[model samples]
Target: MSTATVASAPPAPRVQKRGTPLAKKRQWRAAYLFVIPFFVVFITMLIVPLFYSGYLSFFATRLVGGTSFVGFDNYVKTFTDPLFLAGVGRTGLFLLVQVPIMLGLALFFALALDSGRVRGSKVLRLLIFIPYAIPGVVATLMWGYLYGQDFGPIVQVLSALGLGSPNLLSDSNVLGSMMNIVTWEFVGYNMIIMYSALRSIPAELYEAAEIDGASQLRVAWSIKIPAIRPAILLTVIFSIIGSFQLFNEPSLLRNIAPNAISTSYTPNFYAYNLAFVSQNVNYAAAVAFILGIVIMIVSYVVQLSTQRRERLG
Candidate 1:
């Protein structure tokens, strides 16, 4: 019987002592060097401004007594101020009316493109997304020209066709016109988001649905929509934030429709006018802080409701 001596495995390769502690320290030091600049900029640009704004919101500047600490007086005034309330209500109305239409159109476009039936869908997607690439200021100006009360193509065409040239920028029509512009700009942006989500869904799931003889509509209803609910929710939250921040369009369009677009057209515009036009910096800070709170509360409520609905489902 040969005593088989198991050869001891060649001495295990040492991990080379994961480098000396100094080397590890130097590695971490280098990593921190890369990370510090971002934190510095973030704190300087965002954190400092936010804290400063909060601080400014607490004080009140008065002609009679100069700047003085006023506690929550500005907040109280913000909640009660009719102009601020009116602007909030207008934006709320816009949120209710426009968000659904825009998201619905985006979903429709996403589904259409995903179905692979539309001719030249790639080009169509690019065309749709092109408006979003345009700067908001530029887009507003372009639309302002198109919605012009005089010499606009729409008015000219309507007159030529004897359909009666309606004033698109009239007080009653301007909000709706703005809605159209926002929808036109953002639908494709939202569509791209949803489309990307749809693309990430497993093809096997689609194949299985097809094997079950599910129609396109049925597949989308049961599979596509449910799978992309997170993306939809993200879009909803973004739309809500954007609706509250509806400043650029109204501010620029005020030039075209002075009577229709007032200084307090939206919360953001109200804050801007308070700061620059009326020279109410303290009050503007308060208004901005309040607006930020409103946005935060609304976004929180939406996320909470969505969470509850998902859990229940």
Candidate 2:
């Protein structure tokens, strides 16, 4: 019987654990796999186009001579081109007027929401944000119709009231009208940025402010505004970029506003017209890069100023 007993199965082979280096290697591989898609798209869509455009900026394409490298000739021409210079100035005006009004309204709304005194704050916030959710093109078209002197609500109201309709589409008033539309579209987005920053502040600071009998205004001025300066700076930078990149509304409204919105109303508009309408892709690439450089410089200046302020503070 003892001799006939079945041999016990050999102990199962021990499973080998992955060593530290192997585990790290596997983790890195997975991380790289996750990142590869974004890198590919970024290079294909943004970086490659940017470099190609940069290369083109150094060359000039002529009707008779074809394309030839001209060093910084394109850059010099871009800086001196009257149309491009006018577009840059127009864009600067847009930034100066629209940015302040938009940011001011946004800050006000954010402060009101953070006050905790407004009724139905969530509903109000949602309503405020609805305009931003709309596509810029749609918003432009809707507002363009509203500004119409023909059958729009504004004209109808004025007619009913026996008052003459103000021409919002007129060259004299069109820039202001554009400002209003931009402000309406972006105020909420900026408000959300500020409100989020306000929300992130430590509750203890609020409590302490309250203990000192600080009013809502004082608390906001001293505690909230100072606390959210970085967020405000971020919004300022974003607004600056958006102001310079003012293409969609003007472009979409061009059909209805040919008299007011010129083909080169903004630097972006100029680049677009040059590339598509005039069939001047090379020079358009140059203008586009020049604007990009300007944006980069402005943004860098803003960030640098903020850094210096932080160091001083």
Clashing pairs in 2: none
Over 75-185, each residue of candidate 1 has an lDDT whose tens digit, in order, gives 999999999999999999999999999999999999999999999999999998899999999999999998876799888899899999999999989999999999999
Candidate 2 lDDT tens digits, 23-112: 345556766877999999999999999999899888877778898988888789999999999989988898888898899899999999
Q: What overall lDDT goes with each candidate model?
A: 0.92, 0.88
Tell me each candidate's TM-score: 0.90, 0.89
- Global CA lDDT computed for model 2: 0.88
Best by TM-score: 1
